[model samples]
Target: MTRRCGFAAVIGAPNAGKSTLTNRLVGAKVSIVTQKVQTTRFPVRGVALADEAQIVLVDTPGIFQPRRRLDRAMVRSAWGGAEDADAVVHLVDAPAQLGDSPADRRAQADVETIIAGLKASGKAAILALNKVDAVKREALLGVSAALYETGAYDEAFMISASTGSGVDDLKAKLAERMPEGEWLYPEDQTADLPARLLAAEITREKLYLRVHEELPYSAAVETTAFQERKDGGVRIEQTIYVERESQRPIILGKGGQTLKWIGQKSREDLSVILDRPVHLFLHVTVDERWADKRAFYGDLGLDYDA
Candidate 1:
């Protein structure tokens, strides 16, 4: 039997359900999902097996207009993911694109940016109009047709990534498009992220979930150590860096209750994902320039000069 294996880069605006779709495609929680924009800061590769095809799904960061160095790096990384892929998927939040709210307008603009970028690259992407369950049939069809008319997309799919609606068809399309080649990862492997990095991402997800509104984007989590214990358990140490001293209390909360809760949740998730007893230790520190540091970018697999 012939085997197929290649990368499929998923690119879209912030909060367009790209991560959710990637997780759905991979049939596992390889990428983290939250009700927040710009949560993903880098490209995360998740392995998906569709029949004889091994689809290496590259869940790139959401692309949008950049105003900061980190934002530029993320945008560059997102496009770079598309540059080396056998397939490219442009996921859009259908409701957001058709709505008239200010946030929706912003989302629409970001989609426009993606379409313009695709046109410049001269690469046609498989358009996946996500969140179709949240919009009306007529409006969804109108928006889908308009987007397809732009010629940036070669094919279209209407899917709700969260509900798994119409996702199987999208998966089948991706599988058939994969190039005939050897598998890049073991069939049992679900993701290509380092364990330590994934642990840090889990912690960060917890942090954002707990205090996302209270805290800004100036906070990050990094795993300092990971040790295999003699008792067949794993011990992990991590630090949460903040840009301001005043912001530290927001994450720590009154009498450290917030930080404690974050740690407990992170440990619970890490234990389940790793299938081992996990001892997670968390620390909060004020690192005024964590975002500007080269080491921080390096750890997240981002370019400091981009």
Candidate 2:
């Protein structure tokens, strides 16, 4: 049998489970997953090797209304992922589309934005109605209808990214769609993200999970130091930058409690992922304009100004 390989850019709105789907298809976490909106700030490519097929999944940032330089850049990167891919999977959160809440309506609007982009580019996508585990069958049918009516998708799949339901079928379909060619990446390589970026993302995940409102959005973490211990363990040092001194105390908590919690959670995740004990050091600092500067975004392989 000939080898099959190509890129499949998984694009969608925030909280759409695109990251979760990518992680599942790749069998490991590459892009960070969070409850907060706009969690993914750039594209993270995760490679999914299935039998003779190698699907290089470009997990792009959630597309949303761009209110700042960072947002514009992120949104640009998201569409860029789709424009350059051999296949595109627009993963929609089906539950959100079914619910009668303002958040749900917002999710619908984002999906429409993607459909519009596909139409403008004359691109046909593989629509994946994700999070079906949380939604009723009838609701999923509604989502499927809306997407199908748009005529923006060539195929569709209903999947539960977190539960692995219908995922194997989706993977088979995605693999079948690959064009015959040599693999773009080694079969053993799971993700294209650098360790530093992944480390920073893990911390950011904890931040979004534990913090609230403006703090998580106003802050970013970068790995400043990574060293190997003689005992075959790893030590990581990261600096968390916030936009204000007042927010620093919020992140640090009354007795430096919040920071410690963040450190513990991040270290736990690192240990599990690396399959070795990890020592994580986290320090909080205020860098009010980190989000507005080009150099900072460049470090994460993102242009600050779109």
Candidate 3:
């Protein structure tokens, strides 16, 4: 039997559980997830090997309004991820559609945007009503019906990215969409992202957990140094750069409390992910124009011009 392989982009609005879904589908945590919106800023590729099929899952950033250079790049990557996809899964947060909530509105807008993008590319997509674990079956039907009206999605899968409910079914459908070909990656590989980028993503996850408002978006993390020990462990040094000096104290908190907390959390997460003893050194820096600096995004393995 011939093996199958292709790209499947998981595009969705902010906090729509795209990262969580991607991780579940790949059977590993390739992207970070938090309660805050816009936690994912780059296109994270997670390779899923299911029954001799290779599904490269593209976990993109939340599609929303662009207000800054970084935001523009992130939004660009989100849609751009769908360009060459063999399958596009539009994961919509069902609960947000109850009223005139921003997530509800964002959900509508992003669906239209995805439709436009797909139309221009002459491609069809699949709609996945995510977070079904938190809502009712009837409510999910409403979201599915509304999105199906777009005439852009060929299929709809209601799944919960967190509770592992209905996720395997969606993953199987996505895997079946792969073109007839050999596997594109090694069987053991789960992601195309480099370790440094994964390290930065882990730090970004901690930052999003510790910071509030738009601070998480204005800040970027970079892995400055990484060393592997003789005992097969790793030592990593990271820097979290905020766009303004005033934001520094907030991240640092009283007596360096917040920064310490963030560091501990990041280290704990990294240890689990790397499966090794990680000596993580975290520092907070103030960069008045880091967002405007294209090189900064490039360092994170992201497309600055996207």
How large is the C-alpha RMSD of every model relative to the true structure? Answer: 0.9, 1.7, 1.9
lDDT by residue for model 2 over 146-166, one digit each (tens)?
779988988988889999998
Q: Tell me how far candidate 2 lies from the true structure as C-alpha RMSD in angstroms.
A: 1.7
Using TM-score as the yardstick, the better of models 1 and 3 is 1
Question: lDDT per prediction?
Answer: 0.93, 0.87, 0.83
Residue range 1-306, candidate 3, lDDT tens digits: 678999999987788889999999989889998877788878999998879789999999888778777778888888888887889998877777664876577776765776677667777788888778777778778778977887788888888889888888888898789999988889998889888889888888888888866474577888999999999889999998887888888888899998889888888888988889888888889887877786777765566776
Give the poorly placed runs of model 3, Cα more than 4 Å off. 213-216, 301-303
Q: What's the candidate order when arranged by decreasing lDDT?
A: 1, 2, 3
Residue 226's lDDT within candidate 2 is 88
Better of 1 and 2 by lDDT: 1
- For model 3, the local distance difference test gives 0.83
Considering summed lDDT, which 10 consecutive residues are worst modelled in model 3? 297-306
TM-scores, all models, native as reference:
0.98, 0.94, 0.93
Q: What shift in Å separates residue 205 of candidate 1 from its native position after superposition?
A: 0.5
Per-residue error (Å), model 3, residue 160? 1.1
- The per-residue C-alpha lDDT of model 1 at residue 172 equals 93
